[model samples]
Target: MGTPKQFLFLELFMQLLRIAFGKNMVCYWDMKSSIGYRYSKFTSNHLIQGSANCSHLVYASAHFDAITFEIHFPQHDPPLPIFKPKTLKQSHPKLKVYLSLGGDDDANDKYDQLKYLHLMEGSEHAQQKFIIRTIKFLKLHQFDGLDLAFPLPRNQPSQQSNIGAFLNDVNRMWGSPTTT
Candidate 1:
């Protein structure tokens, strides 16, 4: 049985569905768990399809306004989807699927993700390139949008400003009718 909060959330979600005014309930799925095929059967049927079994129970895809696949970075080699996002989209047309950038990594070299995010948006040229490539990657992979998952570390003013500027650029690009 779920907690009272979970039940209340479900009730709210159901009400939203009835009224056709859904709240933004974002579900973040880590690439490692998704790619490893360790998802539950309910998840498989509703959100993603996989052969492996698990005990964890995930809410239906319709409950979420969007699902974000975590930890892809802006680089020359774009990410390839191990879990087929196209299938999920086809199954739940109203559910938005986003590709997230920057996340914690176990490997020491890739651990400081904020640093990579900074380097990606260090200059005007680099920022533009990152946005263009990200857009292209999203289009290619059928992603609804890009999620900048970079955390603003405490006392890091420069990093925060860079992230803010980069976000503004991203918003400008996506908000424009001409750009995709």
Candidate 2:
């Protein structure tokens, strides 16, 4: 049997081995967890852990290469951050933080998030506006990049092509100082 500290070291060792072999060590910190969602234990009645915080990652920052903060598409022109990431970035200067867009928490919703994504893709003006606003949002929040987490609809070739085009457009404008 290994002690808690020994197990922690073993976990770190395994993470290093995986990284050495070129495996990505990415972590997604959901907004729900960040805003205080406690996780309970399955067996017996006991609380396992509290909401996730930057301190949790700061302690074992070496194990992660990047961390993605999940957020939904903007209802307005520019998206707002659910939590401030300045402290985390300052604590671990080398860690890359990304803003993940387009995740659905409710499966029972009549229209999927993909519907809105498709709508945005259909209109060139909408796509351009979204790209511009997203870039500014990333710069304002000090995000390393954007992660589009929108899942492709089944048997929708046009939607897939549209997403590709959107990605290309974003990449093109990402290097520009002003995308107007």
My TM-score estimates for the predictions, one after another, are 0.58, 0.60
**Which sections of candidate 2 miss by over 4 Å?**
1-14, 17-19, 22-24, 34-81, 106-112
Q: Residue by residue across 102-128, what tens digits does model 2's lDDT show? A: 555322344543554554466777666
Model 1 stretches astray by more than 4 angstroms: 1-24, 34-46, 49-81, 106-114, 151-154, 177-180
Evaluate residue 32 in candidate 1 and report its C-alpha lDDT on the 0 to 100 scale: 39
* Candidate lDDT (C-alpha), each: 0.49, 0.48
Local distance difference test, candidate 2: 0.48
Number of the top candidate by lDDT?
Answer: 1
